[model samples]
Target: MPVTTQSWVVTQRLPDLLFAADARDEPISLTAADYRALHWAWSEAIGDYTRRTVTKPGDKLVAFAAIAELFQRTWRAEYLAGLWRPTLLQDLLWATNYEGRAPRPERYRAPSWSWAAVDGHVVASLLDDWLGAGVGTAVQRCEVLECEVVPATPLLPLGKVLSGTLRLRAAMVKATWDPDAQLPVLYAALDRLEEATLTSPPATSPAPELTQIGCAYPDSTEDACEIWAVPVLWNKAEKYAAGLVITPAATEGVYRRVGCFHSPEPDEDPGRLVWMLEQKKQEIIII
Candidate 1:
């Protein structure tokens, strides 16, 4: 038998790597790259915690309250359910990962835009990383006019949410369902392009051969009918985008987030998303 060495090792870098960049006494102030690493650590924790199977499904936000409280001291920012206010736009970019996931709870939890609203693994968008890397400059498409979250227990504000809503002004476009792929299609958006072409003809006739612009990862495929695509951030230089997929709520002008979608994935074209953004801008509420 080969000589075996008996040794004990202490991995000091284990937890340090996670919280080293985070601020303790003072708020975190670092270079763009370092700040992004800090955000990644927090996002990873949220992603892992959301995937866990719990005895009380309603305790989703409650379970993570301590962690949120801890970060609150350092972040010094308002906590909007599962997301933070400072980076709310990027935080809105989370999407449900339905692989081996259970159905959402019947009881009310958080709003549809929040990760706590769903029961499954979720991934936060990499838009911050992409921006920090200087890949492209981001032009915010959605203006977060107002946001509010009501807590179940006034004493434990961060524990459980009663109701939440976001008032926004963004470009909203209707999408049709694709029965074959079980996804939403932007067939109507092309009409805008035709209208623009007719009004102001370009030097060359622009014929866009696009059937499906980008992917729409809906929270519930069964209830994703009559959906709309709302592009939040558009990186024109790099040709990439990210936005929310929403459906109309019971209220006349109110909508609810069903899921989120990003562009330039595989064969998808970002130009189509750019076209979608040019359609029209409207002020709407999401709850």
Candidate 2:
């Protein structure tokens, strides 16, 4: 059985500036043009983080790598040039209390979040044995569904691109599941994503089996999280919209009938779980 939890991934082509954290002494300055090459001394490296430092090595170097120009145009370009290493820490861990951990991920299981097919590549990096240079800590947090997290793993400093997403999961999950839920930096980044669909790939997907988890908070909340998504349509232009199905409110239609996850959010974690379901919906749109 797939152990469900909150997670997301970013997918994009390999960049030239991406260095190996294992090669701490390698050149860090790189442009999009250098993303892929046959030979580089330290191309494959994994970064590590502990809760002590304000910023880790991977954050420092990867941040520079994300922006090709930062290294090229800064007044201290030559001085900062020496800091380019794959192990650069763009994010550092902060100590916080988390009650439980996300269940160990199952193979080929649906991640708590999804992305365009291309973005899936970056998402897969976390599972790698060497684990790459930038994604470990947050993954560790996700292990416990540490709700207070910033979710920096999926962004990857954007190879200097620094972008966002389309729609994101509303923080309406069960308190039992989302523990310390709060708005995350990744929440805001989703905005850069196009509101409308960009793909029209046909939906030959098999019907997904629905596995309903009872709403953690129902009376004062929006709707419960969906168990799984079924491929009902493939038309990206038609676009998919999810909402709440209200039956009691009829005075002026203050409530939605269904698919109303538009923002202002729900009362609690039940909404958070539903939001994760919507994240899957967004993946369907992009796919």
Candidate 3:
């Protein structure tokens, strides 16, 4: 038998050799092309990693910082910071596909209202002005009682949040879901005076059509008819508002978010509207 070689190893850098460029002629400053490449890489990484990570609302900022660090050479600190708000909002609204059909996690991570609780890619409107341009301030205040995250390691890019508490100064009203329409319906016979106050001189015409709004649930299987809708503004100038849909949790007096109601014309004060609808006011909520 021919003598076998004790050991043999080979390695090749074909990609580097094939794609090598003249370093002397390379541009000194980063260009738009460089930025685009960096952004694409970062986005791809986030899309893949977030799908497998268990995220929480309170951990959003920290997660963003970690991702930014990976691309620091290509982006400025201020530019990265500016991306936070919109990213948070986008994650909250469209984090999961078939949201209604998604199963609820047995162990609590983030409140149902937060996008971080869901699993999937988050999408947002490109034209949305996240700097509070058309946004309204419906939430008067927020208090955090506790927020903790697991220590991150090389294997876990996103640390799991242990537990959290959040208190909100909001207004809530009773409502029910219309399965046929896949939206929560709030029926309030529009009072002539209220209609006149909210709308322009269409007084001569039919009373403003029953104020119908689009509503969505964080978990579609929620079957509580005695649901509460809390007013949260998405846009003030445009008279848009989103109602944080809530239901009673296992712990009495503690409410959990289930969905949201989008009102294109929330011209009326939410508190007053609740009163008009003959529903009790829920001033402070803890979750």
Q: Which candidate is the best by lDDT?
A: 1
Candidate 2 Cα misplacement greater than 4 A, ranges? 1-46, 49-52, 55-162, 166-176, 181-287
lDDT of 1 by residue, 25-79 (tens): 4556656665466567668777776666767778888877766665565456799
How well is each residue in 1-287 modelled by candidate 3, as lDDT tens digits? 11112210111211221122223344235555554444444444444444444345345434544444333422432222213222333222332333334455555555554445544543221113421323335322122233223323434323334443445555555555653344445543333444355556554655533444434544444355566665544443444445566778778877776665555333343322332223333454435
The sequence of per-residue lDDT tens digits that candidate 2 reaches over residues 1-287 is: 11111110110232323323225554455443342231121122111111123133233323323333322322123111212222111111111112221221222111112111011111111112212223333221111111121223444332212222112222222111121232111121122222344576434544433322222111112232321222211112212212221222233312211111212223321223232334433211100
Instruction: Compute the lDDT of residue 170 as modeled in candidate 2.
Output: 24
- Please state the error at residue 270 of candidate 3 in Å: 16
Q: How many backbone clashes does candidate 3 have?
A: 1
Candidate 2 colliding pairs, count: 48
Candidate 3 deviant stretches above 4 angstroms = 1-95, 124-158, 179-213, 234-236, 265-283
TM-score of every candidate relative to the true structure:
0.79, 0.19, 0.49
Clashing pairs in 1: none
In candidate 2, how many Å is residue 155 off? 19
Greater-TM-score candidate between 1 and 3: 1
